[model samples]
Target chain A: MDNRPIGVFDSGLGGLTVLKEIIKVLPNENIVYFGDTARVPYGPRSKEAIIKYTFQAINFLMSKNVKAIVIACNTATARSLKEAQSKYNIPIIGVIEAGARTAAYSTKNKIVGVIGTEGTISSKSYNVEIEKLDKDIKIVSKACPLFVPITEEGWANTEVAYLTAKEYLKELLDQGIDSLVLGCTHYPILKRTIGKVVGEEIKLVNPAKETAKDLYDILGKQDILRTVNKDNPIYEYYVSDIPEKFASIGQQFLKRDMDDVKKIEIQKY
Target chain B: MDNRPIGVFDSGLGGLTVLKEIIKVLPNENIVYFGDTARVPYGPRSKEAIIKYTFQAINFLMSKNVKAIVIACNTATARSLKEAQSKYNIPIIGVIEAGARTAAYSTKNKIVGVIGTEGTISSKSYNVEIEKLDKDIKIVSKACPLFVPITEEGWANTEVAYLTAKEYLKELLDQGIDSLVLGCTHYPILKRTIGKVVGEEIKLVNPAKETAKDLYDILGKQDILRTVNKDNPIYEYYVSDIPEKFASIGQQFLKRDMDDVKKIEIQKY
Candidate 1:
């Protein structure tokens, strides 16, 4: 069984949501997370720039000798997942495929809604993946570009955030989809508010949880589950920007003190 | 008189607001602007990272043989202005000082309100600058971090934007301030909504316009104003990420076509 840490990276602290789920599922496994806070909000960037930044983040994770890599950022998954798989020999997992598969299996009406960054919606990666699994599945996707910034600004519970969610999700709800995928990693933090707005009938598919399940299954199949002591598994966090701010906001997702988060220059990778 | 173009740069298209004011004040001078769209939103990054990025942007503008540099970003000005001025040989002007000077001069009640990103507020640069000019002035600052994303998402005119602006501005209004500074470059796009919330009783200071005026005075004193072009001065734009998005959003600021914008890599600098 492999004992190496699983590498997780996103444009910012949103990846901590995925990391939290992964830790819950595999308590014994070590984790190395990198948040590219210095160059975050990859949603509005071009495909070429996303690819370049994602590659650098991946390379930095690889330097830490991770056994597998998890692309926690939806924009990176939509734009550069295939390139990542081809570039690295280690097992690579992205949220888009896992989320799409779960939505395909869980939806009863073959209708789904996806909300993500501009790049993710514009790429139509989830649409293509869901369609590949079931040809009849209809997907409605909207670019909720403000969600990431809202979460970063710590306005998740504020009335302004609720109002913004209503404005951004009104069209998606009007489509009458049975299931909605929280396509971007930062979206789960707003799950309670979004769920309330979208109503209880609409199933909110948290891709971070599904991705953790997918990773658990993959590790099980490969017989690579760590046999180390669960209580003492080491966890490391790295960011390319302000460590203090990361430590502060990251506590919401990690549910623990981030006193040890270290800042590193990822561009050198 | 020196005939070289004046260089202006931001983390993204927000700097176009400053560029627009510069054009209005100095119609005969050529202008060159760079927007680091790929790595925009320097507001949340570390001070060191912001300084590094600003230095790189300055180096890029210097490569273009710019006569002077205008840091059109408030966060950058708050975090990196001193470092930038010390590092670069050319005269560098940031929006913070220009804004603080204007706010100091405009406030009659000595209660001046400032709105910007979290990093800008946390730095306390504007407060320090204003207090230095006149210690009796009371500074009330609020961090409106969502304004950038709201503007970026094209929600500047919707009812949702007005609601968001009201929520963010409520506390500042309660302080009974006579003058307010749009501290972030992106805030200018939301000026109407902000003004509506603050009402006509409070004077809103546009730092970009003040900075442009300062630039005019500096150019006049130095005898570096371009005198060759009276009718048709050239303006060029460059971005580190999406050229198309920059061009489109830039149109809102410059009130002209973005045909002259070119995408270029600035990471090397």
Candidate 2:
């Protein structure tokens, strides 16, 4: 089994949701997470800019000799995943496919709902992926562009957040979807409010969790699982900006003190 | 008169608010705006990073032979305005002093409220500037981080926006501020809701307008005001990321269709 750390990167701290699940499932494996905090909310960026930034993040992660790469950003996955896979020899996975698969499997009446950033929803990547698995599945997609900013502002439980969620999710709920996918990484933080709005009857699938499960199965099959000491696996976190804020917000996702997260200027790379 | 274009720049379209005011005050003068949309929301970035970026933006504007430059962003002004003024020979102005001056002049009870991004509020630049002008003036500052994203999402008038305005302004209102400075350039677009919540008794100072007035006065003093406009004064806009989205949101700030904004890779600069 490989002992090399698995690399995970996102536009910002939202990727910590994916990292949390990865650590929970693969307790012994080392993780190297890069959150592009300086140039976050990649949601509204053009495809060319997203691809260019994603490449920089990937190249940085590769420099660390990661065994596999996980693109924890939905915008990057939708816009640049294939190009990244073609450029790198190491195993590269994106949250979109894992999320699409989970939603496809969980839907009872072939109806699925997806909420993400404007760019992600506009690309219709999730719809195409889900339809590839089951053409009959009806996809209801909404662009909740403000969710990323709301999560970044640490407004997950505030009354304002609940009201914002209600406004963004109202149309999707009216569509009567049985299962919903938190298409953007930032979305998992708002799971409670979103679930309350969508109600208990609708299944809420967190793409981060599904992506973590996919990582587990893939690493298992590839014989790349780190078989090291279980008690204290090293967890390293890197961000493009404000390490102090990242450390605080990261604790919410990791459910542990973030003493190890460091800030690095990724633009210089 | 020098007859050179005035340069204005921000991390994104927020700077357009300043540009719009400048155009209104000096219609005959040419204008150039640069938006670092690719690496926007400089609010969360380090002081050093903000300085570096502000320098680059200034240099770019200087390259256009601009008569003067305006740091149209609150975070940039808070972190890098002094360095920028010292580094460049051209007369440079920032929103902080203009906004602080207006707040000091407009406040009846000598209690001035300010709202902006986390970095802007944390820096307490407005408080410092206002206090420097009048120590007797009491200052109340809150970080309304969600406003930037809400403004970006074109949710200025939605019910969610009204609720967000109410939640963010409640504490500031409780302080019994007589005047509030739209500390961030993006805040002007939310003036209606912010005014509604704080009530008409509280004077809302548009910093961009005050900054524009300051700019006009500075240029007039320097003999740089354009005397002749043989043709329609053209406006050129440049953004580092998605041109389409920037153009759309920029329209709201400039109050005109932005058919001329071009996307450029500013990281290389």
User: Tens digit of lDDT per residue, candidate 2, span A114-194?
Assistant: 988777888999999999999999999988767876786678887777888888878877888999999888788888988
Write one digit per residue (lDDT tens) for candidate 2, span B1-269: 66678899998889898888998999998888999987776866678988999988887888889999999998899889999988889999999898899999989899889988777887889999999989999999888777877887788887778888887888888989999988889999998988788888999999999999999899989888896778778788888777446777889878987787777767666
Interface RMSD of each: 3.5, 3.6
Sequence-dependent TM-score of model 2? 0.81
Residue A176 error for model 1, in Å? 5.3
The residue-level lDDT of candidate 1 at B82 comes to 92
DockQ per model, Cα: 0.39, 0.36
Worst 10 residues of 1 chain B by lDDT: B241-250
How much does each candidate deviate from the true structure in C-alpha RMSD? 4.4, 4.3
Model 1: clashing residue pairs?
none
Q: Write the per-residue lDDT of candidate 1 for residues A34-76, one digit (tens) a residue.
A: 9998787777666888889989998999899998889998888
lDDT of 2 at B268: 61
**Residue pairs with backbone atoms closer than 3 Å in model 2 (clashes):** none
